[model samples]
Target chain A: MEHLDYSNQAAWTRVSGDKQSPVALSDSLAVKNDFETTLSFNYDHTASYVRDTGAGIEVGLHGTANIGNRPFSLNQFHIHTPSEHTVNDKSYEAEIHFVHEASDGRLAVVAVLVQSGAASQTYDAVLAHMNQKETFDIPVDDIMPENKAYYHYIGSLTTPPLTENVEWYVLKQPVTLSTEQINHLKTFYSHNNRDLQALNDRPIISSN
Target chain B: MEHLDYSNQAAWTRVSGDKQSPVALSDSLAVKNDFETTLSFNYDHTASYVRDTGAGIEVGLHGTANIGNRPFSLNQFHIHTPSEHTVNDKSYEAEIHFVHEASDGRLAVVAVLVQSGAASQTYDAVLAHMNQKETFDIPVDDIMPENKAYYHYIGSLTTPPLTENVEWYVLKQPVTLSTEQINHLKTFYSHNNRDLQALNDRPIISSN
Candidate 1:
């Protein structure tokens, strides 16, 4: 635990196949998908009764979403300090991983790029419990931005075990957090984002 | 609870949307997706310890599978008598719902058609506890057949509140159970299957 071996990702000792995640995202390079794919999220409004996973994904969160014909249930989501997927080759302050799963055991991680800006009460409520280490549900419905446009691509889980073929749906629009909210997540795990992976000739489909 | 209200589905009163599940499946009508899609399952072997939901879907079983890039974790699975999704417009003897959920709270159900033939010892252990109402995990890895070919579609949950936009990956291959095994499951919920829903111009993707 002392030495976070993210260096393996840079050296390819742990690439786990070429389809790695946290790739550099560019709109110009992204192929516009022919079909209109609007992600519909029926996220639970009240995290009123969810067990706080701290920074894990094993809670029985009951939120759900649909992208095209794919159905994903919210397992649990956590923060990746400093954005993972870069937009226009630029990284943001932080990124939030709203990890979802389909019934077939496939993962569709909705990466919402987070930036420090106008005070967001929605984020404030979620962030308040970030450091508490208590049982709390992150009100995911409020975490989502109104814009649903996202970049779709086949990739791997950014974290350990680095499972490949995980769907990366990086929302085109970024969400805001107050400076306090941003630092609250950052203090837990600063510089926690993984090194960006190469696109590897993969087509990043833009949901226009 | 005395009278099952599946009649609502037959009368369209409970149709959450134009698209609902348990549709009559036909290969010729299924659109062959241009892309090759193979489902990969890395299921847990031991039912060693898992809480059985007693034909419900609120257990935290940790088997996972990948259909393309979508990742779903096995929440829990239950059986439906006389099958649900009919193949070639013919209903099978029984069906197993291996319900998996993605991180975003969407469901991708992999329906395995069942036929009574040879006794499957793999199933014998699972069936032993059907009526026991005990804490047991249905070994989903055992339930999936060797042949991965399936018919994929956009549908709603066959059960109540009937949420739509659920991805149904109905496996074309049918597995066998002994006459005794079939009877064991049947005794629990005889004729518990939902009525078939309209195809409604939904494209059932044949994953050949």
Candidate 2:
């Protein structure tokens, strides 16, 4: 197999191959890696959670070609207090993660920047439900737009063990939420952000 | 705080709270027990990949919500030949996984089912690219759609330590792919699937 060239955007097509081992035992013992992917939520795509707090994708939205052509069904979404990647040592107030995977084991993620701004139409639906202070659930399909543009790259596990080889798709444009929405997130996660670590030997590729 | 109630569906909103944790190491671990809510794509989302031969999600294109969320942006997805899940006494042909994480310290995943079928759109895209084969590399902002409807639960790492407390979101519905697509996947990984282990008394919650 050829070594992957992180600088080449087109190289992703060639590098997309399976690892001999699906799970690494050694990586598991390294407790320093505190995060694990192991949760599921089933709901209508149009529903929203009152406790939604500006984090998490609204449950029940659906998308095509979003999951390697397998058609990924949307679940719920959440936010990371403080941003994960620091642009020049500066992190944002928070980062939004849109996690998805295909039935054939093809994974994809859409990262959106969450900045303080006026209420965005995209976010108003969710914010409205949040303000209700009552039992509220809305379908994501009802609120989400149909834009499918994004950024992509190959990187490591940002957490511990920092596993390398995972694929990444970061959005160049950010989805909007309001200042009040951001503050609401802060209330729940006053300082939920994690500090930015060194890039190490990770390679970041920009599709644009 | 009130413990999350798994039995009632309508009561989800009243019961679910921000439940966001502070900067505690264990709190950070809270991410380990949470579900993801966004859809992501490979840097080469447009480029296609072979879908491994098998009975389920790995056959063509699939989606995973079982991806870990936090510390790193959720990246591209792939599958393993054979299968990681076990049945009454047998395993399937293969399994698919959606990998995800952030920079600070969070990880999550979402998995789906791939049964036998005809050729899939994903299969076509991946095959065309593989035919023009080259090295591997990840792209930024590949192809991302705003879909967030999914099923959320809690389970152990499909891999080792077989760590527990992993927040899982397995979608109830699954997309289909073709036999040709499945065969194409066999090209790169014929036996990447893992054997299913014990459930370890883990409770699967339908976070609808």
Candidate 3:
């Protein structure tokens, strides 16, 4: 990974490659309701990575998903403040990315948006353990929205090496968090989000 | 210095800080003809730095300049394909940055835009030595334009740490290079330039 200052100009070049990218997510996506599955996570404080921009708390997960006949097991998960992917061009306060990988090394990421609102028990539990630097088990379902609708597309990693051709599934509905919880997260990561890349004429399929 | 990939999106974030920034260059700068001085450089092949996006050939220089009573000595110089700074919103194909520093650590950068047209003997010499990885000496005057008109502003380095409050002198007149020469440089650094940064409501002094 390149030493990248998320807050610098070196992070604002064009997205290249012949592949399609960052297609907008609206209600026009083709719905696929097969994403339903149970995922388990263990909060490992030491697994967190820190940069000048923000902190990425890695969560260990145990589960798998089958997208388009390709099975991807949950590899790891991390958090990004102010979100990376946008929904209809609107960004959220935070985002949770569950990175999964297939036996052949293909990747599929599930993104859950977080917005400021009522306090979330899941977030509270995670933050409490995070503050203590202790380990705890969490049911991924506890952090997901009741609605399972998502927008699917092909995009690249937000960080360096920016490997392309990853399958993306961004939830349409956002989970809620208290303003205080949001502020607490910000205390760890002030600004750690990448600017939006161009769509490059890609299509975003909505799980209607 | 942070590991930076100029060809990626990590190179495109807003320049932020409490310090002043590079403003636009219009026809309003107070021209000081005192920039006239002799600068000598030896193109030591082993003095080059390479990255994924491009290569920076370090040129040793000897000279000094005074902008507003602050004296800055010529430090080193590098090249960027596709100009980084824009002149009144206009950008060129490429740019050369001559970085200068004061005893107190303050910086001043002199930028010379590169365009495709007539063949330039200076560029040809530099390119020849660069291709052969040999050492050669160049007179700074040979690469400068007849018109010393420039745009002055305060901006940060397009790369990382993005230290602010650097004095900038962008020559309004551009130097020419042959199309083949431009293409050759591009072959090494096709997309190694940072996107134009915002003026941040700062004033751009046009050196009339």
Candidate 4:
């Protein structure tokens, strides 16, 4: 299998362009607040979130999230330095994508933006064990934020063969990670994010 | 996430009842041998082939396989200490499930049985890297067999939520792994296979 270059002009590139990207979400879109997500940190140490780039320090967390009456299994979550999606053309320090799939094979992704601020215990815990080569367990709720407001849209995976029609929910709230933590992650994947992509006239919906 | 017990009698348990196992396959079944598969080691390390059992030492390989005119991406593959499916009441030492999914979220799986015989370099490579905590790349063709003859059927994932209507292709040929390799895998998951399920009158077709 060939490794995809995250910083190239690949068709599956996830970099969001300022124009045609997701706009400030509005409240007109249907909002479902009861999304239930459960996380288990029993991940494979050999799994890489991004191909090549030597960023193989990812843990597969087995989880399931219930959204809009549909049950999605949380397959994997990886961090992208400098983030993928932009808000009104503003990029964050990092982005965490919680990839979920329904039984029928439909995909729903929850994007959480990471910024430098107060130290987060969740981030600290993840960083602490990032170098472990063995599978372990962790509580899902401990790492998730209480805020559930999000910007919903339909987009494709930012990676190769970039499969489209993926249901995306970008949380309006940003998760806090200290400056030291952000820098530590960058050591693994610096500038390892895709360029902004065309929104193709997709509407960005927000939960009221 | 809490590790799922593979030996338990959960509703989604993969253990099949010996009395109602799949019978010998016939040649009348539709056997598509030319299904095209492309491999990419670009997978989310957070994804597990098995639902639980805390076997997080697995790797996620990304690539698409064309089956029945539909393109299914090779998301992840995992090993069961003992084979999950039985043929005419015969069970192998282990089973490898190559899980593939279509763009619309439909799943098609290819199951290859592993037994003790000559040393297999592919299995050795996978076992060699099983303890690594980082994601890396490997050739899909190296791990897959040249022969495509298989048994066709419709079943559910042996894991939780046990989604049904999944297209299954169990290769007729068994891959050989040294006794040392099989025992090494058992060290991680001795009785990790689920109990056999009742066939429910579903016909198993052979690609003869």
Candidate 5:
């Protein structure tokens, strides 16, 4: 077994781009661009989370995904407190990111917004194993909303090395978890989200 | 939500005892003390391994066991390459530590010595997730040898703080792993063992 740095080296090319992430998502501004090839998720296997980075918790994934006929492999997912990208200027309690990568180095990040309400068993499992820093079954598909409709755009990662050319999908429907669950996660991270960036005249595609 | 050292604080109590671990086990000099309540393992969950400790891979366990009717919950297990204790003055390839704790904070370390031979699927799973540092199902019982008989004694932990008063149970049977698997583990850690401790007048009890 080879000793690894445990990070995607390709994301650290040191290039800044105009299209940054966490932009305010407005339904009125987003253009409906529902094409024949829609986004599809083929999630399976339990994911393991790592606390190696100062960015907080990041869970490694081993699932496949397809966006507009382009194939990508899900690599990892992480969370942002108080949400990052707003839905029609309305911020939620939290946001979860499912990051994927293609063989050619293409990246796709499917994000889900979370609100306070009923308890999510999926969130419950993640919360139990979060501090252990060991891989427990993550149930990647359950973390998403049933609607599956989303807002799409091109943006760079909010974290350092700030890689660009990544595909961003912010789901339309928000999933609810018990307030205690959201609060428990916040205990590990709070206000860790990147500040809202400018849209820069970029068109937001709605996958309605 | 507080940051933790992730190690047992009780094991760090600084008191070097005459009865330390990794002592050479000699059957000819051992005494047979068969008790009514034998060692029993109740394992089910998949354990996740963490790579945080420089001492190499540490897998967190959620299983319970009984050593002579004294109940203990297993907290973690770790691998030491090139073996630690010698059986009949003959050394093996590796040694594994299943660190357990009783309600009263009494420590019990169950060890299994490994030799070079056939491949072990149990070891294969551990090798797969050792670097990932996430909790995967550990199947704790499989990690043990079929023979329940072991050599019992008193000792201190082999690592730092080296707290004494630990109940040591080094199984008599030596489990086997492929030469390649042992080498693969050696790639991560090699010759990382505490120096052989003296017998120091402690009687080794053989569960024959």
Candidate 6:
């Protein structure tokens, strides 16, 4: 019930560091409602990516994500390098995150794993906007992909202050890109990844 | 941008059957930019554990969660069984989801993996409410443990019509509960799980 800041040291410590406590699965947090409006991806909202001061490429992935019947608009895409999650003790170059939210206070995200690949239109859009002199939104309509199939699960934060109770939906298959795509990303965020943490004996469910 | 109901047969068929068509991560369809609260957790509010229609017993090990500088709140906990995700061909009993959101459309979640353990106070809170006959919040303030360490990553929906673009934080270590807790969960919802889908070559990262 208490509100917190993005940089609240104490609160952040509690959220990013509390791993010993048990957490209940809040059913109310699930996306059980229908969104009233429809939103589409804006391949043109190109903006510079910046997390913890590191700069990279970012594009908006628009969509309508509803919760409790209230619709939230999803926007923006970014990546973390070195993979924050480990599957059977394996990690990858980086992971992509799509952020979304509803009008009343509902959140939903669609995450995709980025591995070594060829040049991807999405990545290209991000790269075009990568520059120390620029930090603005761009148009991404030309490069946005059209695939929607995905895998869903509920997981925790991969970073420190390991909080629990987040829903996850990973795509079963990845969109294809060229090797150039991976290299382009690496150019901006060569090591933009968190290390692999322990599974903590948790099971990941595939929402097929 | 077009708004769509997830259950709409036409929408489902349109997006479900196609692989190449762009399932845009559209944000306009759903409501966006309404919630504006911090992302944090609270234990007091998570007293009433409802056997989610699908997820089994969800014990609120920690209190409500607070996101980074947002208005939405992380209310409670829940779980998915039989492994919705597979790291490298392995699975666990169940996964716990700690959901959170902010008022201005910011969302953050911390996920923890649970294994079989001896019955403890945390499990008792959940088991006590397992009957589904009662509908009230539980009192789990005393037994809640501290979770300050974890791994963080960004991911998406773990189910069908997988949405993209969200942040993720998974704890490296899994908290423990008694085998009774696991059994108690199973007694109520035996087959409430999703199968593990293909990895799709997605790279997982750890926020360690």
Candidate-wise lDDT, in order: 0.68, 0.40, 0.60, 0.58, 0.72, 0.44
Q: Please identify model 3 stretches exceeding 4 Å from their true place.
A: A1-23, A28-55, A131-134, B1-9, B12-208
Better of 1 and 5 by DockQ: 1
On lDDT, the leading prediction is 5
For model 3 the TM-score comes to 0.41
TM-score of chain A of each: 0.82, 0.55, 0.73, 0.71, 0.86, 0.58
> What docking class should model 6 receive?
incorrect
Compute DockQ for each candidate against the true complex: 0.02, 0.03, 0.02, 0.02, 0.01, 0.03
Model 4 chain A: ten consecutive residues of lowest lDDT = A13-22
Residue lDDT tens for model 2, A88-119: 33456666655565432334555555566655
The positional error of residue A23 in candidate 6, measured at the CA in angstroms, is: 37
In candidate 1, what are the lDDT values of residues A1-208, reduced to their tens digit?
Answer: 1222222322312112456778998988888775556798887655542233333312234588886555678876666678889999889988878788765445789888888787667566655543344456455554578998998887877765466546788998888888887777666556666777777777788887
lDDT by residue (B42-126, candidate 1, tens digit) is: 7665554323343332223457888655567876666777887899878888887877876544578888898988776656666
Per-residue CA lDDT of candidate 5, range B1-208, in tens? 3422213322322222455667998889688763443788886577756563766577776688977555678888888877778889988799988899754345789998888887888777777775676767655555688888888877767765455556788888888889898888887876666668888877787887
The runs of at least 3 residues in candidate 1 whose Cα sits more than 4 Å from the true structure, single-residue gaps closed, are A1-208, B1-16, B48-60, B131-142
Error of 1 at B15 (Å): 11
Candidate 1 chain B, poorest ten consecutive residues by summed lDDT: B6-15
Which CAPRI tier for candidate 2? incorrect
- TM-score for candidate 2, please give it: 0.36
Q: Write the per-residue lDDT of candidate 4 for residues A101-182, one digit (tens) a residue.
A: 7543456778788888876665555665665554544544533567766777666566542444467778777887889888
In the range B25-127, model 2's lDDT, one tens digit per residue, is 1111122213333544433333234332222222122222223233334444555554444322334444455555543223455554455564455545444
How does model 2 fare in lDDT?
Answer: 0.40
Off by over 4 Å in 2: A1-45, A48-70, A88-90, A105-107, A131-149, A154-166, A197-200, B1-208
- Between candidates 3 and 6, the one scoring higher on lDDT is 3
Please, what are the lDDT tens digits per residue for candidate 5 over residues A51-143? Answer: 534565666667888764556788878887889899877999989888897543446798899899988787777666654656677655557
The model with the greatest TM-score is 1
Residue ranges of candidate 5 with Cα displaced over 4 Å: A1-208, B1-16
For each of the candidates, what fraction of the native contacts does it recover?
0.00, 0.00, 0.04, 0.00, 0.00, 0.02
**Models sorted by lDDT, best on top:** 5, 1, 3, 4, 6, 2
